[model samples]
Target: MLNIGVIGAGRMGLNHSRNLRQLDTIKLAGVYDILPEKATAYANEFGAKIYQSPEELINAKDIGLIIITSPTYCHIEALRIALDAHKPIFCEKPLCRTQEELDELIPLITNYDNFFALGFVRRYSPNFAKMKEVVDSGELGKLLCGEIRCLHGRYVRMHGDWFADYDKCGGVMLDMLAHHVDLQNHLIGEAESIYAQSFMLNQNEDELPFDYVSATARFKNGFISNIQCSWLRNAPSDTEMTICGDKASITFSDSKGLLLTKGGKTEKIPVDEAALNIHKIQGGMYAEEMAYIVDAVINGKKPLAGAKEAIDAMTFCFGMMTSAETGELVKF
Candidate 1:
């Protein structure tokens, strides 16, 4: 069994821990968070030990993999500890707020002979994976254009002081757009230029300006894509994408599930057999992602979403933020 150590007990960290618990091929060796109670709670629930410090978890000989779900600011240091300990790592999105941080981690990444997978869970979702298959099989014909819209309500209770700070979370664009951009890059390829518009609609003394963000991207492959994300929408969390092609069109929705409308007819694609399992026990995308990471490590194969893919997505997001600030299109 692959010995795993989790380094946070926040929402994302808790989700990953639950998924890891379901897998028989892996064991949750320990968990560490700045809050001792949080770490201890997760450890006891999972029947795993709780380490007093991150360094202790990283240095443990039994931990074959380190999962970093800590706050965005602490990611670099957590990753550094894991690298120094010569352990494989699986990190959450927005690797770092700045390029320099990523650059510094590159040498360590190259030197460590272990697996590293970034969390871009959309790539592992069955609906999106099928869309990719259709595109690759030439069933979609020439990919002329694509559109992605991701909207969700911000958990007011969940947005604590640290997450509310723009400097730490990099605002809504970095924290949320990274997922859509990663999915776009995964399905439609790299973008050549980006034109974006963003704003802070709802603000209070207790919260930061991370309520809404939007961007339109022009891909190098002559396809155009748009993405919208929000933390203030009252709608029931809509996430849908449509890829328009010469022959047909493909679309899917997280709210209504997979959909295909083409040839003057619309049909709901049958949900994958794995979907029930994914939704029931594993909590949808998170479970799929955990399985993908385990397979990547054991098979010595690259994951559907990796560091380079994440970087491409983040580069576009950074450019979008720049565009929003300067009122100009940014070219990659």
Candidate 2:
């Protein structure tokens, strides 16, 4: 069994723990969180040991894999520890809060030979994977412009939660939209330029750092892409994206399988959920991503998403943030 240690016991961390527990080839060996009670809670529920610090957990002899699901700012430290120990790692998305930090860490990461994967779960979703295959097969003809939209109800952060702070989470741009940004980069190409703007809708005493962002990017492949994300006080939660090519267009979501529009007709491409077997796990996308990294670690297989893509996505996200902050287009 591939023994794994987890850093952080929050929502995403707990979700990872539950998914790790479901995998037969992986064992939840230990967990550490800044809060002692949180670590204790996770350890008791998952039947793993509780370590006093991240240093101790990553250094544990039994932990062959380290899963870092801590806050965005905390990822660098945990990653450094895991890299130093030469342990394979799976870290949550938006690798870090800033471009400078990510750039500094990239060289250090290049020195390690161990496996490193990022949690861009959409790549693991069956519907999206099929869409990628169809797009890459030239079935859609030459790809053109695309649109990605994600919206969620008011994200009122806890009193001291870093997620509510722009310095820590980079707001919706990093915490939420980074997933689609990564997907766009994967499906389209590297972003060449970006223009964006944001709004802080919550004007109350308990204000959020950043709320809504609308941006457009031009890809190196000569395709234009638009993205809009929001965390309004009262709004519906939805995520959907569409890509249009010369001959056809593809669209996908959790609710909608995959749709292709071609020759003046729309068709739904059937996705074999049973064959994917991701439905067998109760933890949803988190479970699928966790299982993917576990398989990669044990079998010496390359993961669908890893550190390079994660860094690229973060680079795009930070560019968008810079554009919004300066009210000007950012060029790469």
Q: Report the number of the highest-TM-score candidate.
A: 2
Per-prediction TM-score to the true structure, in the order listed = 0.88, 0.94
> Highest lDDT, which number?
2
Clashing pairs in 2: none
Steric clash pairs (candidate 1):
none
lDDT at position 92, candidate 1 = 93
**Per-residue accuracy of model 1 over 14-89 as CA lDDT, tens digit each:** 8888887788789888899999888878878887789988999999988888899998888998988887777778
User: Which stretches of model 1 miss by more than 4 angstroms?
Assistant: 106-112, 154-160, 200-210, 233-236, 275-282
lDDT of 2 by residue, 1-332 (tens): 99989899998898888777887787888999999999889988988899998999999888999989899999988988888888898888878878888888788665659898888888877788888889899988999999998988756665356776677888888888989898888888888999998862333446544389899999988999989898776787778889999999999865666899999998999886754565366666667778778888999998888777887888899899889889999999
Name the runs in model 2 displaced over 4 angstroms: 154-159, 200-210, 278-280
In Å, residue 112's CA in model 2 sits off its true spot by: 2.7
Q: Residue 328 in model 2: shift from native, Å? A: 1.9
lDDT of 2: 0.84
